[model samples]
Target: MARRGKKKGRPVSGWVVLDKPVGMGSTEAVAKVKWLFNAEKAGHAGTLDPLASGMLPIALGEATKTVPYVQDGAKIYRFTVAWGEERSTDDLEGQATKNSDKRPARAEVEALLPAYTGVIMQTPPQFSAIKIAGERAYDLARGGAVVDIPAREVEIGRLEIVEHSPERTLFEIECGKGTYVRSLARDMGRDLGCFGHVADLRRMEVDPFTADDFVTIAELETARFGEAGRGKPSSDGQAPQEEIRLPDRFEDIDALLVDTVVALDCLPQVSVSDDTASRIRLGNSVVIRGRDAPVEAEEACATARGRLVAIGAIEQGMFKPKRVFGG
Candidate 1:
């Protein structure tokens, strides 16, 4: 048998809530963060378009297993709609497909908010990643094929105007997963008799994560170099002698990581003893003790001494381990 080479990168694990910059796709962002941390594995909780900027929670190593929780969570976005022209892609990146001279008034725009809230059927933008018979919709759209994508149900928790003018309208919305801000602008424009498209968009929150958890790429770069890269100004106002120092150790930058269990904030959690945790790690079902413990849970996590032990289900007072974690 041939000897397999050891996997590259360290087994560093945790979440890196990135304040993703515009013009960088989600895949690229994940790759960059993975390289920066030299993690064994990496993934992102949700996809953020290259044109949009804001909170992008990235998972490394064992944290990747918890991505589904974050992806399924509610999202809040602030976007601007530029009136007059509707683009093929429904954003600034595409060519104009429809034009309108009429612009909606502030009151008229506000009036439309009530109709958009709650559960609504929305057709996703043509230039989206949605699959059509194993082919990506964006690929088909790029090839000049206009697909008749069906409208699907999406929940909008809140929709309110942040600012409004005759030429443009800014709105903030809290919506469920699979909701597209571009589609929202396009549909609203059609209803108001003034064709419009997304001019700028920024995601402000994603479930457990908010702007408070954001760490920018620039900040990451600075953290990588450490204080050795900083130079103190000379008192004489001239120049200070250069002091060269070796770069900080790898562990220095790991401080920015949010605990892997943070992603499970929305799920039910159970605390287990060390012996029980060991059993869970071996893929065994253990009886959950305590009167306050949940009788059953479709999705839950078990922790041992504050560390994640497993993610699985609780049924009939028993916790069955599905995905176990390492120390």
Candidate 2:
């Protein structure tokens, strides 16, 4: 059998907490980050809609293996709901489908919060990625076909109003995975007897990540192009006045990247010896030492020499490697 060819690009691994601007799709952002780093692999923790802006944690290289952990983490969103009309897609991008003259007052919305605070069933918007018979629901909706989408259980940890007016209301919500802010606005509008839709949406947090770690596209572009110039003016007046050239190496772009182990900070960490790390690298289980070490855990990660070795569960004082880190 012919050997598989080596993949092109560097084996760079880490998380890029992107402050995604509105109008850029999640896939496009991931591709751009991957290209900027020249990484062999890249993926995102969660999908951010083109109409939304905020933290989109992108995984590069070996970091892709830990994508699910970040995806399952709680997320926080700050959004504004425009009253008096409910749109077809539940956001500003869609056409208004339902209209109402009645506007919900501040007190009316506050009273309805308790009903939506806990675990509640939510029906995703028509223009959602939910599959219906192997086809995307959004595709069907775009084709002018209205399909019955079932409601799924989602957890809303906290929901509070930040600002309110007769026209639009701003809100900050902390929710679990699979919770949709668009659906929340739609449901609240329906319950308050005034049709509504999301006017603006911004994700503030994704568990381990917050706005503090976000790197804007402009920052990445600057880092990519900024250092290429020699920072010295040319002797002659012509030829662009200064020397400028392309980056000679990937490190030329000094974009901040969170360590791969940091993404698993929520889980218990077990520091292992070099011998144990060797077993882990071979996808084997090794007995965990130290009296302070956990005897058993549902999820845990083992690190050796200040680097992540593997992520797995602790069973009867043994660390079994489920996912080993190549980085």
- 1-327 per-residue lDDT for model 1 (tens digits): 999999878898999999988988898888877766767899998799999999899999999999999999999999999999999999999999999999999999999999999999999999999999899999999998988899999999999999999999999999999999999999999999999999999999998887888897667656766654343223322224776343446665688888888889998999999999999999999999987899899989999888899999999999999999996
The TM-score of predicted model 2 comes to 0.92
Write out the backbone clash pairs for model 2. Answer: none
Which 10 consecutive residues of model 2 have the lowest summed lDDT? 230-239
Summarize candidate 2's per-residue lDDT along 1-327 as a digit string, tens digits: 999999977888999999998988898888887766767889999999999999999999899998998999999999999999999999999998999999888999999999999899999999999999999999999999998999999999999999999999999999999998899889999988898999999999998987888897667656755644333222221124445554666564544888899899899999988877888999999999997999999889999987899999999999998999873
What TM-score, over all chains together, does every model reach?
0.92, 0.92
> Which runs in model 1 stand beyond 4 Å of their true positions?
227-248
lDDT of 1: 0.88
Q: Evaluated with lDDT, which candidate comes out highest? A: 1
What is each predicted model's overall lDDT from 0 to 1? 0.88, 0.87
Give lDDT: candidate 1, residue 254. 87
lDDT accuracy of residue 206 in candidate 1: 91
lDDT score of residue 240 within candidate 2:
40
